[model samples]
Target: MAVDVLNESNWAVEPRVFSDLGLWVMDQMKISTDCDLTIIFNEPDAMEELHLRWMNLEGPTDVMSFPMDELRPGDGTTDVEGMLGDIVLCPAVAATQAQSAGHSTIEELMLLTIHGCLHLLGFDHSDKDQEKEMFGIQRQLLLTYLAARPGELNEVIPLEISGE
Candidate 1:
């Protein structure tokens, strides 16, 4: 997977970690190595504009996904490869949610990163059953990702989505 991270936020972000997280998600989804993914950390203003234009929402959201190829996870084939799309994240907004959720800003960003990638891969929580399946896979992937990096575990807790 070709993963690129563009940080345009005021806060300092570990771009490599975001790249690794994106790649790991692709691996877990069995996407081909030829696929491309980009993660963008933007200021709240930029995010708000995007939210208004694309989603027609009024404010900055935590994360937004723009999928290019409409790839779905675990189709069990890598015969096709293309741009997976961009995950635009607003750290400024995530910080507020992190405080409420009792986790570090980085942890919240990580969770949002995974959540955004899942969306790019055609995962959604449009209904109760979809929420269960998506959040279950999300939590499992996050836990495994955290467990694999014990040192980074200090930087992140086991994230618990409120409704999951």
Candidate 2:
């Protein structure tokens, strides 16, 4: 899997963490090694513009996904491959949400990354059942990712991934 994280925001960003999360999400979903995904971090002003333009929402949201190729999760027998879409993130907004959610900004960002990946893989939460299924998968993905990492809880680092 090819994962790239571009920081287009004013905040200092760790490109590896986001890239690592993307690779993890791809592997967990049984996506092919040839798949590519991009995650971009943006400022709230830019994010607000995107939110209004793309989603038609009024304010900046924590995350938004634009899926291309419409890739879906695959069975282990045959992994799916495509140019998975982009995940746009707002760190300033994530910080505020993290404060309310009682976690660090990085944790919130990581969760949003997984959520965005799910969206890229065609997961939706429009209804109650859909919400349950999607969110359950999200929680499971987070936990499994956490469990696989080799670090202290406070200093969790994303896995390092290179080309297969």
Candidate 3:
């Protein structure tokens, strides 16, 4: 997968980290490596505008997903691929969340990235049943990713999501 990351915020965003993680995530989802995805880091102002415009909410959110191809996790034998869509992230909001959750900002960003990808894959947590399924998958993905790439991780990031 071609994972492109753009930093438009003042925060120190590491494009490679997100790109690599995104690619791995798509692979895990049985998506073709030819797929393209974009992750953009925006400031609070831009995020707030998007939150209001898209969700009719008043505050900036940590992440928002705009899906393109409306893709789903492929069947085990299919190599699904397409323009998966964009994940707009607010690092500033994530930093505050990280602080409150007692973890590094990067960890929060990673979780958000995973959440955003799942969204692009047609996952939602609007209801309890949906939340259970989504969060469980999320937890498994994070734990597996962390275990497989300990060298890339500085520490065992505490799971901050309402994931089982």
Candidate 4:
């Protein structure tokens, strides 16, 4: 998968974190295609638009997904290879949420990326059962990612959204 990260937001984030997120998403999903994923950081106001359009809310959301195609079983056709989708993140919202959740902004961003990627992979948390399954897997993947790099460990923070 080709993961492209674009930082257009006013907030600051390390580039390597974005790359790590791409790898984590690919590994967790077991997606073995030349998928192209773009992580764009947009203005907080832009996210408000998404909140109104997608979630029917009046405020900004942490992340949004724009899948290019519906999730389908892979065919033998290698024409498209694999183009999963694009995940747009609002760093400002992430930062704010991170502060409220008492965690680093990077952790918040990573969680948002994982959440968006899960949506692209057809994981939704709108229902109770689905929320448990999806959030459980998200936390597992996040713990794995964090454990792999112990040097970067700052704290064992809890996730904002729980499996329950």
Candidate 5:
């Protein structure tokens, strides 16, 4: 898969870190070699609009995925060089979630990036079985990535889901 990073936010996180996470997620998902992914980091206000539309919430969300179902393999619209879809992220919300979860903002942002990428690949947690499977893979991927990063220290927490 091809990965492109676009940063339009003033958040404190490093751009390289976010880009690396996007690449990491694409690798873990085993996305088709033909797929293309673009990640855009935007300010909280811009992300809030997507949060309201897709998530029905009133605040910034860490990440949101916009998958392109119209662009398929063999479609003339897909250039061998075109993107599959976009993943938008808000570093502000990621920082807050990291503070609550007791991890670095970078880690939280990476987790959200992976989650969004999975959604692009048709993974969802809208039900019990799906939630279990999706979140389980998420937690595992996050732990493995964190463990492999040099000088990174993080505590492993049990996976849990609250509310339906």
Candidate 6:
């Protein structure tokens, strides 16, 4: 999987973790290794414009996904491979949600990353059953990712982002 992270926000961004989360989501969804994905961190003003233009919502949201290739999970067929499109994330919004959730901003961002990736993979939560399945899978993925990391409790893992 080739995951590209671009940060154009005022807040501190962790590109490596975003890339890792993309890869992890792809792996869990059985996407092909040749798949390419992009995650972008942008300012609230830009996000608000996108929210209004794409979703027709009034305010800036935490994350928005624009999936390309229309890739769906494999059903006794070959796995998906191609550009997975872009995920636009607003760190400012995430920070507020993090405070409300009583967690660090990075944790909240990680959750949002997983959520965006799921949307890119054709997961929807518009209905009750869909919400249950999507949220359940999100929780499972977060737990699995956390368990696999080697770090102290509540520690924000240091990430080294190269080449911006």
* Superior candidate under lDDT, 1 versus 5: 1
lDDT for every model? Answer: 0.85, 0.85, 0.87, 0.75, 0.71, 0.83
Ranked candidates, highest lDDT first: 3, 2, 1, 6, 4, 5
Per-residue accuracy of model 5 over 1-164 as CA lDDT, tens digit each: 36778878775444556566666665555444346778888888999988998889988888899987533323333333235588898877877788899977767778888788778767889999999988998889888887888654333221222231
User: Which tens-of-lDDT digit does each residue in 42-161 have in candidate 2?
Assistant: 988999999999989998999999999999999888889889989999988988888899987888888999999999999999999999999999989888887888552356442222
Off by over 4 Å in 5: 69-82, 152-164
What TM-score does each of the candidates earn?
Answer: 0.89, 0.90, 0.91, 0.82, 0.75, 0.89
Give the Å error, residue 54, model 6: 0.5
Which candidate achieves the best lDDT against the true structure?
A: 3
The digit string of per-residue lDDT tens for model 1 on 85-159 reads: 999999889989999999888888888999998999889999999999989988888889998998884653333
- Top of the candidates by TM-score: 3
How well does candidate 4 match the true structure in TM-score terms?
0.82
Q: How accurate is candidate 2 locally (lDDT)?
A: 0.85
Model 5 root-mean-square deviation: 8.1
Please give, for residues 1-164, the per-residue lDDT of candidate 4 as tens digits: 37878877766556567766676667556664457778888888988997899878898888999887755333434333367788989877888888999987778888889888888878899999999998998888888888888865354342233233
Q: What is the Cα-based TM-score of model 3? A: 0.91
Tens-digit lDDT string for candidate 6 (22-77): 88788778787568888999888999999999989998999999999877765536
